[model samples]
Target: MEKLKEVHVSRDEKEAMLSEAMGQWWLGAIGTMMKTMGPEATMKAYGPTMRQIGRDRASRFIKEKGYKGHDVMATASVIRIWEKMMGIEGQFLEASTGRVVFRNTKCPLSGTVPQARPSLEYAM
Candidate 1:
């Protein structure tokens, strides 16, 4: 048996590491789906599933983050935080009603795997 060693990771580094892992996992999942279901079918099936996942995740985030107030902006706020944590580059647009909208122009997973683009929309 070998002794285990412990290493320290800063909060920012941990976040970055987790983000990278998540991006790679997403790419791999899309690749697997595309190979198994073909690109068009994969997009059609994967898109809705991803959208639901996004909605579910946003709901969980709002609850965990203790975002009190109207539910309208809760999802948006959690999503913005999530996007930043995941290192997605984009702009936040201000709607007429003062709600901020996030749009990602560049995503690591989508850039590498074009077929994964639809997943990005759901994540937004």
Candidate 2:
């Protein structure tokens, strides 16, 4: 096996890299599954598994981050961070007092949706 070289990146760069890697992994998994198992099988097998993974990730994030309280603003902030890290281009709006709304105009996952994988598209 070849030894890996160490590389350095800033915190923001690291977050962006991780986000891109995750997006690639998600889409790649779906494509691979769809190719090997057909769309139906991919939907049936991969969809639920993906949903579970997301749920588990969120749970772990909450636990590890030690986030407290049920503040909607806090939740929105967390979501915004995640979205930024995921390379999602969007805007957050202050619709009213104590109301924060996020509108995603561009998503890394959207471009891949037209390739005929409903499971992947919907999951995105």
Candidate 3:
């Protein structure tokens, strides 16, 4: 009983906090410019967004053509591009003080790369 009480925190909680901190750092440093990667920012952020947009459209493949979105889903670099703003896609503005909260990564049961599972996107 004492051993259990002695425990300070769970590993999951620590990892979550760490991940959030990293995300905040990204935002503080370049998230603003990345979201506004428009005439107000650089072309680097643009590439990721464009890729995400294309990927989103590709998602339609499941319904339109029965294609899965697995490998593409797990790609941290790719998902992070759209994860900005909590995957709130389709707009220049988001809930984060006019700036988008970029993810650059996916979470368990959150966003998955194109997979064979039909539950992913209404499956084909």
Best candidate, TM-score: 1
lDDT of each: 0.71, 0.70, 0.43
Of the two candidates 1 and 3, the one with more favorable TM-score, higher being better, is 1
lDDT of 3 by residue, 1-124 (tens): 3555565778989887888786555434443453344323433434466457566765764568664445523343334543453443333333332334332234332332222112212211
Query: Which stretch of 10 consecutive residues in model 1 shows the poorest summed lDDT?
Result: 94-103
Off by over 4 Å in 3: 1-7, 31-41, 45-124
In candidate 1, position 97 carries an lDDT of 42
lDDT of candidate 2 over 8-79, digit per residue (tens): 889999987887787677678777777788887777776787678766866787899987645777667666
Error of 3 at 74 (Å): 12
* Candidates sorted by lDDT, best first: 1, 2, 3
Summarize candidate 1's per-residue lDDT along 1-124 as a digit string, tens digits.
9988989999999988997788788788887888788887877887787778876876776689776655546556666676676667888666434466666787655556666666565446
State in Å the error of residue 116, model 3.
Answer: 32
